[model samples]
Target: MESLLELKDVSIDFQSKRKSFNIIKNINLKIDRKMKYGIVGESGSGKSLTSLAVMNLLSDNLSIGQGEIILRTDEEKVLNHLSKKEMRNVRGEDIAMIFQEPMTALDPLYTIEYQIIEVLRYHRKMSKKEMREKAIAMLTSVGISRPEKIMNDYPHQLSGGMRQRVMIAMALVTEPKLLIADEPTTALDVTIQAQILDLMNDLTDEHGTSILMITHDLGVILETCDRVAVMYAGQVVEESTVKNVFDNPQHPYTQGLLKSIKTLGDRSEKLYSIPGNVPTPDEYQELGCRFATRCPFAFEKCFNEEPPAFQVGSDQTSKCWLHDEEANPNE
Candidate 1:
């Protein structure tokens, strides 16, 4: 299937007086039309940066060193080389994003009705009465009760879950083709989290919307994603179907992550964890393999030279020396 969105060798770099660093390195991913894709990694692994880059929302100080974020519509392909003004028009209308924090994303001064109506008016070219009706309907669809009353309430008046639903409603009010949800349920309780996830899944399925889900929760990815990308130190270590990733992860880091998840009847009085910390960008700048510092299987070759992406299967690849034919021919 043709991809709706594609990121080819994308990288983001940051510079400071202390040093310069590449936060994202040669990242490549693709999301097909109506596909739900997940990007998972620990904090500081550049998952958020990757999403921001795609949305053209990176801070002014950060620079995209290389690669292209290509958004494909049936009409045309848009490369990330467009001016800021052009990008702005595409952002919320064609592609919308739900931020990690709902309160921050919303205006405290405005009522939910005002905010949702604004997006509808700006993007849908609807009349005042029509936009107001649609906004209330959207809020109701997202599981907000007494939608008429909630619409008049400000952001601070609503609970966390309600605020999140309002955020989702606002994003959907634009009827965007692509939705980028960054930890959409992180702040909600387990029951509410499940409801939010279900709501997102149902709405996207109904709308045939493509989603780029950025999350650290493996459970969320397992439940929601068609495919998964695992990142470590700004680079994708392994990527494949969600089932393949759980059943047969290739990279050591991927394996470590899977092992780290707590399982039933596995109380050994100790938690299994990948030891050590992720190498800072500066610390790994001169090393061939960034994960070598924490990886137990690292060899001299791993420290001296970077490994190429090795094909593990039709839809899976891993960037590790162990997967390299020249390095491990017997396997």
Candidate 2:
């Protein structure tokens, strides 16, 4: 299948007075039309930053150091170098984002009707009546009850789930070709989270909109994504089909993540967790593998040199020395 979006060797850096540091490094991702691609990792693992890079929404202090974020539709375009005006034109129309926290993403001062209509006003030349009808319909489609009443209500007037639905409606209001859902269910309760995920899945399926789902939750990735990328300390440690990742995790980070998930009838006294915290960008190793510090299977080679992505299967790869054929000849 042809790719809808591709991030090739994308890296983002944070600039400081004395020096600069990498935040996200060597990100390579491909999202095909109607494909649900999940990026899973711990907090501060650059999952959200990767999505922001795709959207060209990174902060002023943080900039793409080297790489191409290519958006392929009727024609291919590099998003990193686009002018502000050009980016604005593409943002809501071609690529829309549903932020992690709807409360902060949505303007509390504006009515839901106004907010939804605002998107149409910028992207389409619809009349007030037409925009209102479309907005209400969108709310209804997202499973919001009494759409008309919800439209008049402010962000605080609705519950967390309702607020999230409003954010989804605003994002999809333009019927964007690619949707970047940054932890869309993070703040919602379990029941509401499931409903929201189902609604997003159905809507994306209906619209044929590709989604880049950024979340730390393995369960959410398994439920919502067709392909999964496991990220640790900014870079992707493993990439494969969702089923393959769950069945045959390649990298140590990936293994740790899977092992941490609690399964039914497990007799363990405590939940499992990966030891050590994710290293900050500035703390990343300059020479050795960034994950080597916390990796259980790390050896002299892992600590002395970085490992390139080793092909594990036809469509699976891991950035770990364990998969290096030359280094592990006996295996």
What TM-score fits each model?
0.96, 0.98
Best by lDDT: 2
Which residue pairs in candidate 2 have backbone atoms (N, alpha carbon, C) closer than 3 angstroms, thus clashing?
none
Model 2 regions lying over 4 Å from their true place = none
* Per-residue lDDT of candidate 2, residues 1-331 (tens digit): 6699999999899997888888888989889999999999999899998988888888988999999999988788899989999999999999999999999999988999999999999999999999999999999999998999999999998999999999999999999999999999999999999999999999999999999999999999989999999998899999999999999999999999999988999988998888899988889987878899888888778888888888999999999988776675346
Identify the leading candidate in terms of TM-score: 2
Whole-structure CA lDDT of model 1: 0.88
Question: Which residue ranges in model 1 land beyond 4 Å of their true spot?
Answer: 329-331
Model 1 weakest lDDT span, ten residues long:
71-80
Locate the minimum summed-lDDT window of 10 residues in model 2.
322-331
Q: What is the C-alpha RMSD of each candidate to the true structure, in Å?
A: 1.4, 1.1
Error of 1 at 316 (Å): 0.6
Give residue 317's error in model 1 in angstroms. Answer: 0.3
